[model samples]
Structures are given as structure tokens and as C-alpha cells.
Target chain A: MTKELFIQGNQACSMGAIEAGCRFFAGYPITPSTEIAEDLAISLPKVGGSFIQMEDELSAIGAIIGASWSGLKSMTATSGPGFSLMQENIGFAHMSETPIVIVNVQRGSPSTGQPTMTGQGDMMQARWGSHGDYEPIAISPSSVQEFFDFTVKGFNLSEKYRVPVILLADEIVGHMRERVLIPDKTEIFKRVAPYENSSDFLPFKADENGTSPMPAFGDGYKVHITGLTHGELGYPSSSPDDHSNLVRRLTNKTLKNRKDIVSVDLKYCDDADIVLISYGSPVRSIIETVKLAREEGIKIGYLKINTIWPFPEEEIAKLNCDDIFVVELNLGQIVYEVERVVKSNANVHLIGEIGGRLPKPTDILDKIKDLV
Target chain B: MKKEIRIGGFGGQGVILSGVIIGKAAALFDRKNSIQSQSYGPEARGGASKSEVIISDEEINYPKIQNPDVLVAISHEALLKYHTDLKRNGILIVDPDLAHMSEISEFIEKNEIKVYQAKVTKIATEEIGLRIVANIVMIGVITKITNIISVDSAKKAIIDTVPKGTEEKNIKAFDAGYNLDFN
Candidate 1:
């Protein structure tokens, strides 16, 4: 039975992570996302899990990576500034192919603009923030229910793909309270463990599924792992051939399995002339505009992107509509991705703003009205 | 169809809590779908605060209320800021002592929107003997006027959510607001 309860988005996130088999949490307290750490601090220890309030954001993610290497599902969360501080470690996670979940409850930024306000300005940062050409999995939640469910999916995708997964929550969804149905324990997915035999273990060796099994440290496997380019045996290799193979494997693992990582929601998109694309807190407003537009006999549809990365290109391509408007809190981040997916087949418009405010439904409805 | 309701007031006035109670009653107790969201500026204690609760029989697509069908203004400042957004036939409820209703009387008259005044503070202080419970009274009065949810359901929701030892006084406040004559 699904138990229903009222909870804040941050608390739901913590509960979701705990239920997803995440036993380790390391983070610093920051506005809009601090309740996550506080809840984890109390809940983790009670369940025989471990929670550490790290000295800084960088160390927080560092500890999480270390904990993941120790064979535990680990996660860390922060706002814009802390997210920035953790970027190097994020790149480290990407390069090392460590399975970890990072929850970024975004606030208005470019630098501490509005600590308590909500924005989707970090859409691009989530994709390209860590200074690399690696593929990242970022999911945005529009409500408290998604806040709970997506955290579980985030961990699942992280384990399945052996890459970092980001739960891109914002201030609005983080602080808001709503009813969420908690799933049963049996419904949760656990990560696939490494082989039991120590003699045959190759930490970075690819299986038929393109994912390498991770052996926990202190398991007597005598594994050697490094951020530096490594061979199949997990040892640093100076040969150019080894470097090429390691990089290609790390990148292709996510790309080859894009179908498993990407997720989205389409509402009344079929038989509609115009498509409104949005994510996170702004999607709530866009949903309102679509309903109001439909009431006025406007044939409009919506595509709410649940997963931001591994960008759902095939779904957007399938829409095959003439008019598309990508709405977000930033000026033109996700809009570019939509443009790439649609190419020149559709006219892609951008409805956006900056600094602590969300685009209103009337603003979006007015645009859709003009198109129709 | 979706019905959007925005309730705005100071932080401790129970404006946000009132919205939550109504939303819970509709979504859980009454078995109707509802979504509640609140926004407050940096000041946690005393800045302008507002909460919106959207209730519908269908799945709620939008959680934010752009234009509210029923606007409950618990403060004079809220009355000044949000009065213009009420729909043509929307209802505006306010405390007569706190808000100068005559200032927007022309707009209300022109738009045919009903404006009801209640002495929420007076009733909470005199009848319920608690000033802090005025917002609960306002919520009961608003529920009565809008008929969005049954009074019995609202009373049950309030009783279930409020802390122990305060249920009796809150029930009195609710009944006082429910039975008060609206002009």
C-alpha cells in the first residue's frame, strides 16, 4: 500500500534517498536545501546509515565519492554556490565513473543573487558545469511527489550507468509542502553488486552490458584506481592507446545506454499545433497556461522534461510540431538543446527571465495565443 | 476545471496554515485533488507572505495560481496588492477593521464581484478568547462563503491538524465564524 503524507520537498528527498539504499550522506547546510541535510542527519543514523556534515561543499562530495568507493550508495546536496564549489569533484566523479547521486537545489545565481528564491538558471551548468565533454544525467522535479520519486530514480540511474546523477531541485520545490505517496520497500531497486570471487575481478573491465562491476575497497581485491587515465586493470597507463580506450569507454557507457537514462512526460501533445516545453518549478506555471489556453479553444500541448540530460532527443523529434516554445528561468540554456533536437523543422521560441523570478502563466499563454 | 485560490497575509497570521488546512481537507479528508504552495521573502518572521492552494476534481497540472477565483486578504497590504487580479465574478473577503473596503468598492461594484466583510479579529478575541486564532476564523468564514468544501469537512480537517488541547477553542472559533451573519 502507498502511504500518503504531507512533507516538504527537502525532507521527501532525504527519505527517498534513504529508501533507495543510500547509506551515506555528506553535505553542508545551505538555504532552500538545508532541510535535506538536517533530516538525513537524524534519519541516517537511526537506520544504521551514516551522515556527516562536511566542513565544505567540496569535501562533502569528496567524502561521498570515497563512501561510494567503499561500496555504499552515497549522495550529497547543495545550492548554486556549493554546487560550484563541488564542480571539480563532480568532474572527478564523472572521470572516475563513480556511481553517486548529487542533488542540486538551485537558487538564483551567477553569484549569491537570491539565496531563498527559485530559478532554473543552472540548466546549462548541470550539463556542462564540471568542465568536460562527458554526458551527465540531470533530472528536474516539478512537485513534491517527483521530489521523492526522482531521487530514487536518480540513484537507480546512477548505479545502472556508473555515472553521476543530479536531482536538480530549486527553491520553490525544495521548500514547498504537498502530499506524496511513499512507495513500498519491495518496490525499491538495489544496485547490482560485484562478483563474489576475488581472483577474477577486474574493476574497470567491461561486461557485456558495457558497465563494469564495482568492487568495494577492503574486499581483498587489491584494486588500484586513479583519476588519471587508466587501463582496463584500473592502473594508471601512460600509453596513448590506453588513454583513448578509457575516455571512450567512460563516455560511451552513458551514450550507448541513453534509452535507460532519459525520461519525460507529454501532456496533450498529440493533435496540437504548438508545443510548450518546460521543466522544474516553471513547469507548474506552464501546465496552468496550457489548461487555460485549452479552455479558450486553443489547441496547445506540453512536454515536461523529467530527465534533463541524455537529452530526450527522440521524444522531441517525434513531436513533429511546427511551433515550439521552450520556457525556463534562464535566458537561453535548455532552449539551445531544443533547437538542436528540432533542427530547422520547427520555429523554437524562448520564454525566460533571470534573477529569482519565474515566468508567469499569462506570459506563456500570451505567447501561445499569438502563435495560434 | 481548476479552481485557484490565493491566501495572503503576514507570516504568523495563519494565512499559509489556513491555505494548508483547506487544501488538506479537499485533497485528503474530502477526497478531492489539491495542490498547495507558499512563497515568502527573506524575512522569515514578518515580511509579506502568500500561499496558493489549487483544488480540482481532475489532476492538477498547474500548482501556481495566476489569477485567483477567491482572494482572501488577511492584511491591508495584501488587499492593496492583489485586489486587481480577482476575476469578474470572484469573491473578495477581508477584515473590515484592517482593510479599507470602500477604496476598491468601485472596482468591485463595476465587476460585480462580491466583497464580504467579517470582524475576524473581534470574534476570535471576544468569543474564542484567543487573538491568534483569528486566521482560523477567517478560513471558516471563507469556506462558508465559497462553499468550496463542506463546513463539516473543514472543521474535521482543522481538528485533525491542530495541536492537542487547542481543538475545543478552534472548533468554537470555527463555529463563531460559520454562524456569523455576512452583509
Candidate 2:
């Protein structure tokens, strides 16, 4: 029998994290993402884990990073304003190659924007907010079920690559309640543990896959992880070649395996003249828009991105449609990536909405008609 | 088939809970698909609030409800505010003790909308002995009129979703709503 429950997206995310062996949570209460914290507070202790409501987003991310270093699966949840505050540590986590999950429930923003509404405005920030030459893995979930599913995958990917995976959820999916099937614990993925003796192990030493065996702190491993460009021994190395190699490897680890890193849900795009694209809440609206457009005799297909980072360039490059419409709650955040990949092969138009408002089906419908 | 329902009232009136229970009844008990979303803000005791639930035999997209097929308003402000968004000839129900019947009747008569009146608060407080169960009362009224989800399914949903230990009162409130006679 399938274990199913109707739950909000945030709660599902918290459940997925707990199921994925995430035992440590540190976060400050923020609108749109507070439910994740609330759920974790109740469940983590019951499961013999630890959850702390930190003073702010910076410390929240910092605490999660520390927990990850201590060899615990950890995560934090926050919205745009809080996410912005966590970027410095997010970059530090990237440089240090610590595995953690950051659930960013996107809300309208440049700063202190709509707190109560939904926005994908932070899409770019999730990728480039940390300010460095590094590749990031971010997943966007459209519905409540995906919120659960993608979160587990986020933890798994973060574990596999030893990097922070952002589950970029928006407010609509965060708050809405829908059915989520909770699979058996055997289906959940746990991080690989290191078995190397202290004498033979170097904390930051990498194999061919750019991932090093991670040893828990106080486990007799003399790990010296730092944010500065480091060598294989986890010690700061400022030599040009050392810096270049470190930075190049940070980007290459995910970029070289971008094929495996990207996941998308494509619908009816094989014969589509116009391919609609979006992530998060706007994807739901575009799905309906595609249906209404098809009824009006428009051959439209859609590509819903599950993985937003690493850009899913291969899929965008493969689109042979005449035109592409990229809709997002914010003004053309991911659309630029679509434009960059589609280039001259297809005409790309962006339908953007701000103030945390999702574009209506009719809004995209009008755009689809204009191209026709 | 897909049906969209909107429930509206003041903040403390359990407006959102009503939508959640209805959606849960259909999806969990009846094995259908439903999605419920609510308006977000600093809702307080007397402030207007809204929740939308879309139930479908198939998967649901477009989570927001527009031109809802059914509207249940527990306050005059809610009825006046949301009646315009109700589908033409769609079902509209309200608590007559709180909503203005003359305005609703005039609007319904002009628009050819189907309207039902229930004294949900009166039934919940007087008969069910708990005024807070008015939302459950409204849910019962909705189930009786729409039959959107089975009565048994809704009863189970009430038990599953409502706060613990109050299931009996809520079930009775729902029954009072289900047994409401309105033409």
C-alpha cells in the first residue's frame, strides 16, 4: 500500500529532508518559508535529530555549513531577503565543498519585496548570488508533490557532489496543499560515508569525479577546510595555478556532468511549433495556457525545468520549435538562459510578472496568439 | 470532470480549513485529485480571508480558482466581494444571518445564478453547541448541495483534518449542514 498524505509543499519538503537523513536544521523564521522551519522543529527532535531557530539567515546557513562539516545532513529554509543574506556563506560552502541543502521559497524581490506573494525573482541569484567562478545545482518544483520529490533529490545530489543544492520553491507551491506519496525508507538515498583511516586521508583530496571522501569532524581526521582557494589538503593556496585549478575544478565537476545534473519534464514538444517554458508556480499557469492554446488550434508544447542550474542548455539547444515563450513570476530571469541557448534557431519572447504575481493562463494565451 | 470552489469569510472563521477539508475529502477519501490554496497576509479576527479548492477527476493544473463553479460566503463582505467571480449560473451559498440576502437575491435573480441559504453559525452554535464549528456546518451544506464528494468521505475528512477530540461536534455540525433545507 502506498503511504500517501495531503500536505503543503513546505511540509512535504521538511518530510522529504527528514526521510533523506537530514538530521540537522537551522533557520530563522521568514514569511513563505517558515513552514519548513516549523515542521522541522516538530519532527527532528522526535527522530532524535537537532533543529535550531537561528537568529538570522546568515547564521542559519553558517550553522548548516558547520553541521555538514560535522558530517550531518543539514538544511535551511528562507525566502528572497533571507536568501540574499546567506549568499556569502553559500559561496563559502561552495569553496569548501560542504554538502547542504538550502530551500529558498522565492518571493518578489530586489530587497524587502513582496513577502506574502510568490516570485521566481531570485532565480538568477541562486546561481550567481555568491559571486565566484563556480557551478551550482538548483532544482525548481512546480507542484506540491514535486516539492517532496525534488527535495529528496536535492539532498541526494548535494550528497553525491558534496555541494549545496538549492530547492528553489515559490510561494504558491509552498503554501498549496496536495497529495504526496511517501515512499518506503528503502527508496531514500543516504550520503556515502568515508572509511579511510586518519593517516591515509586528506579531507579535500579529490578523485576523478571531483568529490573527496568526507570524514566527520572529531573523527581523528585533520581536516583544514577553508573558503580561500585551497589545494588537495584543504589548506589555503594562493598560487595562480593552485587558484586556477581549484576554481576550474569547482566549475568543471558539475559542468562536465551537466547531462546527468539536468532534469526536465517535456510535454508534447516533438511536434510543437511554439514551445512554452517556465519553472515554479508559473509552470502550472503555462500548462493550462498550453491546453487553451491547443484548443484554439495552436500546436504548443512545453518544457518544465526540474533542474534550473547548469541551465539545461542541452534541452534548450535541442528545441526545434519556431518560437519559444518563457514565462516566470519575475521579469525574465531564466528567460535569458533560454535566449542564450535558443539563439537564432528559435524566436524567444519573455512573459514576465513581478510583485510576486504569477502570470495567468490568459496572459500567456495572448502571447501565444500574438506569435501566431 | 473538474470543479472549482471558493470559500470565504473573516480570518477567524476557519475559512481556509473548510477548503482544506473539502479538498482532502475528495482527494484522500474519494481518491480524486484536489489542490487547495489560500490568500496570504496578516489575517486577524474580522479581516476578510479566502481559500480556493479545485477538485478534479484528473490531475489539476492552474491551481488558482477563477470564475469558481461554487462559492460559499460566511460573511456579507465575502459574499459581496466574491459573487462577481462566481461563474454564470454557478451555485452560490451563504450564511443568511451574516450575509445580506436582498443584495444576493437581486444579484442572483439578475445573473440567473443558483443560490442556497444556510444558517451555518446558528446551527453550529445553537444545535452543535460550538460556534467555531460553523465552518464544518458550511462544509456540510456544501456537501449536501453539490454532492461533490461522498458524505462518508466528507465525514472522514472532518475527522482527519479537524483538531483532535472535537470530531464529534464537527460531525454533528456537518450533519446539521447536510440536513439543511433551503430552496
Candidate 3:
């Protein structure tokens, strides 16, 4: 019998991480995201895992990276300000190709914005916050169940690609309690280990799949891990050619396989003249907005993005619609990406909200009525 | 059938827990779809707090309460602040001693609202000997009057939600409210 739970989105995320074999957690308590750390702190030790209350977000990400190298799935949870503090290490994780999950339960932002409210302003920061030429994997959950499902998916993707996966949650979904089915079984992906002999192992060397087999620190393999642009031996390299190869591999590992990495939910889009695209809490409102629009005899639909990073460009490009509405809790973050993908084929519109409030269905429907 | 409920009180009034228990009862045990969301001020206590729950037979798309079918306010300030958002002819549950019927009589009558009075806090504190269980008492009252949540499912939720070893008292508090004759 499948076990069903009525849990907060943050609790579901923590449960999913535990199911995905996350044994190490290091994070500072931050509103909107603190519950994730709070739940894991109690759950991890019971499962013979480790949970550390890091002094700050920087050390939190750093500790997770270290734990990942020490052969354990690790993660950290934080909100906007904390997410910002972890950016440099996020780039470090990218450069070093360490697998970890960072859940940013986003609140209103820039600096110390609305701590108790919801915001998706970090959508752009998730992609470009680290300041580098590497592709990132970020998944946004629309509901409590999706929060659990995508957290496991985040861990799996992080393991498969040896990169930090971002689970971009928001305060609305993080705090809300809803039904989530605890799957009878889960498919966990373990990172491939390198050859047993130390001499044959090159930590930074990319296989045909654009990821090198990872060897744990105590696995009898000599490994040199660094944040510097490194060569195949994982040693810092000044040579431009080595840097180019390493960076390209880091980016291509996920970007090249976007088809397998990205996911979206397209509803009523086949005959839709207008499609509403959104992620996180705003997606819920847009779903209702679609229903209201249909009642008014509008050929409107919605595309809920599961994978935000890698941008799901191919899916947006394939949308054969005349108009597209990108709804978000921020003043137009993901809308630019939708416009970039759709180009001149469709008239792209943005239905953005700030002040940490989810857009109401009637508000979105009014926007549609004004246009159509 | 989708029913939206909003519970409001001071921060320490267990307002949020009531919403959670209701949502849990509906979604987990009662085999209904439910969503619970909350908002509070920066202060940890003594601030206006709110918790909203939506229980539906169909999928719940909008998580927030636009106009609640049932509004349970445990504090007078909360009742006055949120009572206007209650749907026309909606059910309004409150503690008469705490919420003061006079403050809302004009508006309630204007909206054709059904008002149910119970001394939830007094029953919880005097009868159950635990003021913290007032929310549970309110939950019981809500279940009895609104018929929005099942009594058995709510009992299960209360047991699972309250602190360990306090389940019995919480259940008693719930029963006190449940068996009340509000007619």
C-alpha cells in the first residue's frame, strides 16, 4: 500500500532528500527555508546521517561540498539573502564538479526583503548568480507533492552530472500543507566511482558523457579537488586550452543532454492561441486562470515548468501559439527567457507580481481579457 | 464541493495548528484534497496571525482563501479584521467571550451570515485545563457546526499533530467542542 502524507512542502522536500540518500546537511536557519533544515536535523541523525548548523550560508554550501567529496549526498536550504551569500561557493561547486543540492526557498529579495513572504525573484539568480560560464540545473516545484518529487529529482540530477542542483522553492509552497504520496519505491542514481587503482584515476577528465567518474576522498584514490579552473588531473591549469576544455565539459554535461534533463507540463496547448507559462506558486493561479479563460471562450492554456535552468528552450520553441504569457511572482524574470525562445513567432506578455503575493486567477484573467 | 476556511487569532493561539489539523484530516484520513497556508507578522507572539485551509473534492488550484465559506476568529481584533472577507451567508464560528458579537452584529446581519457562538478558550482552559487546546476546541466546534471535516478524521489529525503525551487532553478538548449544543 502506498503511504500518503499531508505535509508541508519543506517537510516533503526533507523526506525526499532522505529517500534520495542525502546523509549530510549543513545550513543556517533562514525563514521560508528553515523548516527544511529543521526537519532534516531531526531526521538525518535517526538515519545515521549528519546534520550541521553552519554559521552562515557560505560555510553551509562549503560544508556540503566537503561532505559530497567525502562520499555522502549532501544539501543545504536557504532563502534569498542566504542564497546570495552562497553564490561564490556555488561557482566553486561548479568549477570543482562537486555534486550537492541547494534548496532556495525563495522570499522577497535583493537584500533582506520580505522574509515571511513568497517571491520568485531569485529565478534569474539561480541561473546566473554564480557569475560563470557554466550551465546549472534548477528545478522549481509548483505544489507540495512536486516539492517532494523534484527534490529527489534534484539529488538524482546532481549525482548524474556531478554538479550542484538548485531546488528553487518559494514561501507559498514551502509553508503550505498538502497531500503527497510517499512512493513505494524510488529510483536512486548513484554517482559512478572511478577505477580502484589511484594511477588510472583522473578526477577532472570527462568521459563520453561529459562527466568524470567520481571517487570519494577515502576511497583509496588520490584526488586533488580545487575551485581553480583545472585540467584532467584536477590540478589548477593556467593553459587556456585546458581551461576551455574543462569549462566546456562542465557546461555541456547538462546542456548537451537538455532533452533528458529538462521537463515541463503542457496543458491544453495543442489548440491554444495563448499559452501561460510559469513556475513555482504562480503556476497554481495560472492553472485556475486557464479554466476561467476557457469559460470565457478563450483558447488559453498553461505550461508549468518543472526544470527552470537549461531554460526548456526546445519546449518553448515548439509552442505553436500566437501569444504567450509568462506569469511569475517577480517583476519579469522568466518572461525574458520566454521571449527569447519565442522570438517574433508569438506576442510574449508578462504577468508579474511582487510584494510577496501570489497572482490571483481573476487578476491574470483580467490581463488576458484586456489583451484578447 | 470545495470549502474554504480561515482561522485567525494571536500568534500563540494555535491558529496555524488548527488549519494544519483540518487540512491533514481532510487530505490524509478523510480522502479529500486540501491545502493549508498561513501568514503572520515578524513578532513570534502577540501579533495578528492567520491560517487558511481549502478542502475540495476536486483538485485545489488556488492555495489562498479569496472568500472563506467559514471564518473562525478566536480574537476580537482578528474577527473584526477578517470577518468582512467571509462569504455571503457563510458560517461564522467564534468564542462569544473573546470575539464580542456586538462588534460584528451589524456586518453579520447585513451579509446574512450564520453565527455560532462557543466559549472555546474557556472550555479549553477551565474544562480541559489547557489553554493551548483552545484551537483544538475551536476545531471540534468547526467540525460539529460546519460539517466541513469529519469528527473521526479530525480526532486522528489532532492526535497526530499535538505534542506527544498531550493527545488525550487535545482529544478531550476536541470532544468538549464537538458535543456542545450550539442550537
Model 3 agreement with the true structure over A1-372: per-residue lDDT tens digits:
677888999999999999999999999999989899999999999999999998898899999999999999999999999999999999999999999999999998879999899999998898999887989999999899999999999999999999899999999999999999999799999889986479887888788889889998889988888988888888888999988888988999989989889999999999999999999999999999999889888998989999999899999999999989999988888999998888999999988899988899999988888986
lDDT of 1: 0.85
lDDT of each: 0.85, 0.89, 0.93
Candidate 3 chain B lowest-lDDT run of ten = B96-105
TM-score of chain A of 1: 0.97
Question: Which sections of candidate 1 miss by over 4 Å?
Answer: A196-200, A267-272, A285-300, A355-362, A369-372, B96-113, B116-132, B163-176, B179-183
With a 3 Å backbone cut-off (N, CA, C), the pairs that clash in candidate 3 are none
Which has the greatest TM-score?
A: 3
Clashing pairs in 2: none
Clashing pairs in 1: none
The per-model DockQ list reads 0.42, 0.77, 0.93
Best by DockQ: 3
Query: Between prediction 1 and prediction 2, which has the larger lDDT?
Result: 2
CAPRI band for model 2: medium
Evaluate model 1: give its TM-score. Answer: 0.89
lDDT of 3 at A133: 96
User: Per-residue lDDT tens digits of candidate 2, residues A1-372?
Assistant: 568898899999999999888999999988899999999999999998899999899999999999998879999999999999999999999999899999999887878777778888888898899887889999999988899888888988898888899999999999999998988762555666667877877777677888877888877888898998888888888799989888888888789878778999899899899999999888999899888888887889999999999789988899989999999887778888998888899999988888766688997888778766
